[model samples]
Target: MTCKEAQNLVMDYINRNLGEKKLESFLKHIRECKECYEELEIYYMIHFAIQRLDSDEHASYDIKHMLEEDLKEAEKSIRRWKIRRSYRYGMIVIAEALLCLIILTQIQGLNAGSMEETSFYRLFFQEETDR
Candidate 1:
């Protein structure tokens, strides 16, 4: 992602509104681009600060740690999503293969039935057929 694109997605990233694929890309860009990472960090600090102001709680909050945790959680979420998607894809493939095998079995049964009816061996005795 370009700096411009990453900059545009800063709020979405902070809000956790990005989809898994989009988030993955954004995270990759943020980790690699120093300027963009700093920009995101600045935005996160401001956003968190505003939230803290509105809340009645007086506990001290670690903004930097919170940001790091957010990033790590996002990564973990993306990995879990990827694993689920892969399993789903694998199941679909297996289902398709089973359906194909069933169809082939049905076709073979029909062909066998037709062959038995039309073949000349049926007209003869079992002993002659063996000869």
Candidate 2:
């Protein structure tokens, strides 16, 4: 994702409004781009502080920790999604492999059925039976 794109998502990100796919991209871009991360951090702080203003007195005092915790949870959510996606991909690959194997096995079974009734099989296997 571009810095421009990441910057644009900052408000949505802070508001917890980004979809999973968008959130993943935004987080990745911010991690790689310090500028974007700082921009996000500033926006998040201001937004969060504003939100805190309307809350109880004690809640407003822990803005830094609250931001850290929220960001950490967001990061963890992306990590969980990554792991699940990888597992799904791996399962798809396995399913494809199983499908190919089934096709090949069916083809081989058809060929063997035809081959066993041929003169070659009679000469090879019937002779063996006689021996």
20-113 in candidate 2: lDDT tens per residue?
8999888888878989978987887888677667664454456556666877899899889889999999999999997986676566657777
In the range 38-100, model 1's lDDT, one tens digit per residue, is 999899999978888899668887887888898999989999999999999999999999798
lDDT of each: 0.83, 0.80
Which segments of model 2 are wrong by more than 4 Å? 1-4, 28-42, 49-58, 114-131
Best by TM-score: 1
Model 2 scores worst on lDDT over the 10 consecutive residues at 55-64
Error of 1 at 68 (Å): 0.8
